[model samples]
Target: MPALRTIPSKAGADPLPSPPREVEPRPATGHLAKAVRRNLTAHGFLIGAVLCFAVFSWYPMIREFLLAFQKTESGRSTWVGFDNFRTVANDPAFWQAWGNTVLYTAFALVLGFAVPFVTALVINEFRHAQGYLRLLVYLPVMLPPVASVLLFKYLYDPGYGLLNELFDLVGLPAQQWLQDPDISLLAVVIASTWMNMGGATLIYLAALQSIPGELYEAAELDGAGLLRKIWHVTVPQTRLVLSLMLLMQVIATMQVFVEPFLLTGGAGPEGSTTTVVYLIYQYAFSFNNYGAAAALGLMLLVLLAGFSAAYVKLSRTEDE
Candidate 1:
């Protein structure tokens, strides 16, 4: 029989030291470094857009404001705060131009805003031939503004114009269109509406198409008439889009220039069609008063910005 001997270490002796474990260090990057690199990548992607906005949008706006407060003489610029604004305000054409611009905006709101909406409604109700009708409405927008304005000028002539001829054919007395100061703005509005309404019509069509049929059905179930249904259901549904379009139309009409310029030589008979933008052109190009032009432009900019701000706030509140 063989017996195995048992071995034991001393109780107080230290155990054999273990081997050192392997540890891999991180890439020497911390959370802050990671965030910095991520932000750099994002900013690199946005640099092009930032530069474009700075150069075209913000820079021009700053320059406009600066020009409003400055005057250049003999190739030297002098700071003249409020002087340019006073000159613009004091000019006899200044008030007339503002009045005409306001009047033009009013006419545009009536025709430009309502015509496209009504057109969209009529076209949307047609299941067939919608495309054709829409095409006809949009065709005017394809024409160049210069050509359109010139054609309209000929049509609005007091003598031997197509419109006057049509009036004669219908056994109606011929009337002066652009020649009369009273209705010159109205005539211009009509031409502008014809030229510009296609885009608004298309936008309205898209908004109308987005509405649900169920809303109309519900309104009908409630014994609502056509007008009632439209008022209660359709208008409520499209209010947001309508408000947005109204704002855009206001901005466009306020900036009108080419039509009045080409149609009536920048100012209609008796200075009837002298819109603010047209007046600005006269100040800058015709009169060579850049300071006054900048001042007048700043005034318009402030007015429109205020109007838009108020409209947007009201719309947002209603939505909420």
Candidate 2:
């Protein structure tokens, strides 16, 4: 196309300014570059976390799911559908292990769940040495778990154990702590409680400290005793924490392994202490049946997941 000439400005008027150039736009990359530069470290950390979970957590879970449906022999894996599940179900130890696990969880709920809260309550009442008491309570948690278990093993010895000696001093019978199947699981529960209660106690203490003292004063004004005040004021105020801790304790107790494994050789006097997780260990390591182990592990996982979902739904319903 031919260029057209512009008309000249009138005399005494400023020359017409040249038409402004329409410069081409540069790439819209400045903001994007700044954003990338600002978040580079965060992105690096996030990617690292995702990779760790993928390799260490998610991959094993996926492998377990696959292994649950397959049989591996001499480095060869073949799909066998639900045969592994059937095998796990048919094992005689299966029901016994489940029963023992349920029983352990019940005992733990009764003892382990309540003891920490009670300790917190007692400690909260103390006007002096509260810090020392907390330290003393939490000391067990700081100790190596294996060392704690071994210490309990010595205290549980049938002959000349400190527990028996204490019983003797109290004019009670020196009951066998770890020898009888009837009491062996209970002994393990006691040891587990002693070992694990510290963290729970501290959590409970913190919750208790947050409770308003005026509630207790009001309860006392209503002629409530200590028990009445606790039942009416403390329990209701700490219900949420109690529920959460209860759920956590149930899940943890169901997976009881290290205590029974170390204290009573995982089976504990005719399998009284054989929990689901210990059974899984037995299947995988002792019996060399990884498929069965995976099947059982999957079952436990599903059950726990269902329980957690149901509990959460119930909690939401109640809140609503």
Candidate 3:
């Protein structure tokens, strides 16, 4: 066997270059960059929507609020804080219109709320003729407001109205409908209920259908009669929907305008049918008093906000 050969060393010469420093490949563009781009693109629509709302909705609301505190002359405004509100408060017609509006809201709510719930319950009990009855009940809702108001106007005519004819047939006195200031609000309420109850009835009907059949069966087994079952099970089950409908009715009825405007020819005899919205319209367009109109609008906003807050609190309480 040959002896092991000695290996040579580069003692004087530069050592072989250290292995090239391990160069990590540069990472692709950072995740943060991509994430930022993705977020901007995804939220672009929301940003645009916010811009539009600010430009259109919020700006106008603020402008109206400011206008409410100012005095206007030939479309120019000067600050006069609280004066417009004072003027509105002092106007005799303001109180009158407010009273009429409150009365109309009350009457409309009572008829609108009760009648629809009753109709929904009755319709729900009938397995047959349900479709036909629903169609008939909802038919008025499909009528254009102008058309419905016009039809009711004719029906409420002083001399030749169908209501008068019916009264005569039933051996009752034929009283003036829309012509009488005392009963004109009631007449409008009746027509409004006829037109609006369809939508409410349908909503209530759907809520009623969603109630559990097991609850009804249990009630029956416990010797609950029909009314008892409804009072205990049906009413409780549908209470949320009922409360929501009640709030909706209050909001809508508070804004009543079109029917009374058309039927009574804008405020009816002795301004008996003048609602707050109607008065606002008259101030803004009819009289061109934008400052006063804006003040009234602010007042309405305050009222609606209070109502909305109450509704939210009530709903939260119910949930708790």
The lDDT leader among the candidates is: 2
- Model 2, 1-320: lDDT tens per residue? 99999877688678879999999886679878988999999999999999999999999999999999999999899999999999999999999999999998999999999999999999999999999999999999999989998898889888978999999998999878888989999999899999999999999999999999999888888999999998999999999999999999989988888899989888988788888999899889988889999999999999999999999999999999
Output the lDDT of residue 47, model 3.
Answer: 92
Give the Å shift of residue 163 in candidate 1: 1.4
TM-score of each: 0.86, 0.89, 0.84
Query: Candidates sorted by lDDT, descending order?
Result: 2, 1, 3
Clashing pairs in 3: none
**149: Cα error in model 2, Å:** 1.7
Candidate 3 is scored at a TM of 0.84
lDDT tens digits, residue span 1-320, model 1: 89988676677678788999999876657866888787997878699889999999999999999999999777777899999999999999989998998889999999999999999998999999988999999999999999898898788777978998999999998878988889888998999999999999999999999999999998888999988987898788888889899999899889999888877787998999998999899888998888889999999999999999999889888768
Q: Count the backbone clashes (under 3 Å) in each candidate.
A: 0, 0, 0
Summarize candidate 3's per-residue lDDT along 1-320 as a digit string, tens digits. Answer: 99999767668667777777888875578776777788986689889999999999999999999989988897778999999899888888899998998898899778989999999999999989999999999999999998898888788776888888898999999888888999999999999999889999999999999998999999989999999998999899998898888888888988888889888876899999999999889988998888899999899889988998999998998789
Residue 178, model 1: lDDT of: 85
After superposing candidate 2 on the true structure, give the runs of residues whose Cα lies further than 4 Å from its correct spot. 1-27
Which candidate, 1 or 2, has the higher TM-score? Answer: 2
Query: Residue 135, candidate 2: how far off, in angstroms?
Result: 1.0
Compared with the true structure, all predictions reach lDDT values of 0.90, 0.93, 0.90
Q: For model 3, what is the C-alpha lDDT against the true structure?
A: 0.90
TM-score of 2: 0.89
